[model samples]
Target: MTDAAAPPGEPEAAVTDGPVTERATCLLAPNPSMMTLEGTNTWVLAEPGAREVVVVDPGPLHEEHLARVAATATAGGRTVALTLLTHGHPDHAEGAERFAELTGSVVRARDAALCRGAEPLVAGELLLVDGLRLSVVPAAGHTADSVALLLPADRALLSGDTVLGRGTTVVDHPDGDLGDYLDTLRRLRATVIDDAVRVVLPGHGPVLRDPAGAIDFYLVHRAKRLAQVESAVEAGHRTPAEVVAHVYADVDRALWPVAERSVRAQLEYLTEHGLI
Candidate 1:
């Protein structure tokens, strides 16, 4: 699935899943849907000439998908040194335990509950997976436990659902805070510009080549959505359902339910900031 054949509505891609950088490879999961787009991108990161690799976001509990990911890790006869999760969403970390069993690797995540035989990931912690280096940076907006991994050598960031390869990610309410999300995005944008990031390996969808540009797009998109939500509120859309009807009217109705959740989040943000 090259950029030319990226399917309708999917982001441009030279390839779907393969070697993304010198050390990164994405294995597209079998799951596909409006929410997942193509599928979850299970990333394998290994150092040059290393004998072991790190697997990220093993995706669902589907046995075949887990096996495929393990196969990809061992393609070069290297072992899986560890499994890292971006978040605890079922779509991303549900297979963590199973994948760990398949590879005999420990699972590590920002959430203590998700870790197995390993301590919870710490912000700014540098992880050495068989020789591959990864920095765990706490972004925590899409979900309170959401985190991103940075591979400095590859100039790539593994942005869970905080930033997607295409489109914008929802700031899920309750667990997800819009204010925190904005802060996270600002930090990520600065990281992209300062770190000179060239690639972004998202948990789901095709890879992103222009990290700065993508983050900028997301920032602008969020500002616009916030403005739109403010206007909807000012226009007398008093409830979440009412606001969704106005702000997300252009979106597919099937997604209106999810849109309402985001709308609720926006309303909370606005209210907290004294804008509504």
Candidate 2:
């Protein structure tokens, strides 16, 4: 299932369009629809005046998409020098191997082994490919392995599923923790308040210009939702589904299933804290 033949949708290429040879290119994943928000976004960061590029999130194991990524990097007079994964989710890493094979680039990530045939990306790692300097920042919570990339020159942050352009992300249980997620959000807020980040290139949805406001809203929203869930549980909602019914009474019923996952995570958190 390469990008080209990726079931009619799925980002067929790692990088589509951006400032061209200026620096970075953004390719939207075809895996769009209501559930995924918009779709996963694969970005290509190239060094100005250089012929080498860094690929981010190969996007699903689709062959056509992989070929497109290879071709796009070539079109920019750049070769894929490295592959970086923000996380190990299938949508972001599944196509990494095939794409790497196509471009002969090494994979760089926090857990390189999660990325087929690549090395792990450690914190404070500085990747200078073709002259572009990328700083790796560990952004856990969305997932324990999630990482964020900072392009200091552009004051930009490449936030994977740890944050979204629209709406708040689920603090899924087992791998995701509400407390940890809040801490991560606070860290991001620090970046925003410090003016270290002016723009956010999220994994899904459009790029966000108001990173501070967005993060603040997410924190407030999550806190409110957690309170609501707590109140619902206190009101006799025993299961996740029941909590969803009470906490999300006005939300679309279709979203209940997804809400249930979050509710369950909250329940577990509460139980661990002896609040249940």
Which prediction has the highest lDDT against the true structure? 1
**Candidate 2, which ten residues in sequence have the lowest lDDT sum?**
1-10
Worst window of 10 by summed lDDT in candidate 1: 1-10
**Runs in model 1 lying further than 4 Å from the true structure:** 1-11
Per-candidate TM equals 0.94, 0.87
Per-residue lDDT tens digits for candidate 1, residues 201-238, read: 88777777777777777777778889999998889989
Model 1 TM-score (2 dp): 0.94
Residue 47 deviation, candidate 2, in Å?
Answer: 2.2
Clashes of 1: 1
Tens-digit lDDT string for candidate 2 (120-203): 888768889868988887787777788888887778888887777666676656676777777888987786667477777778
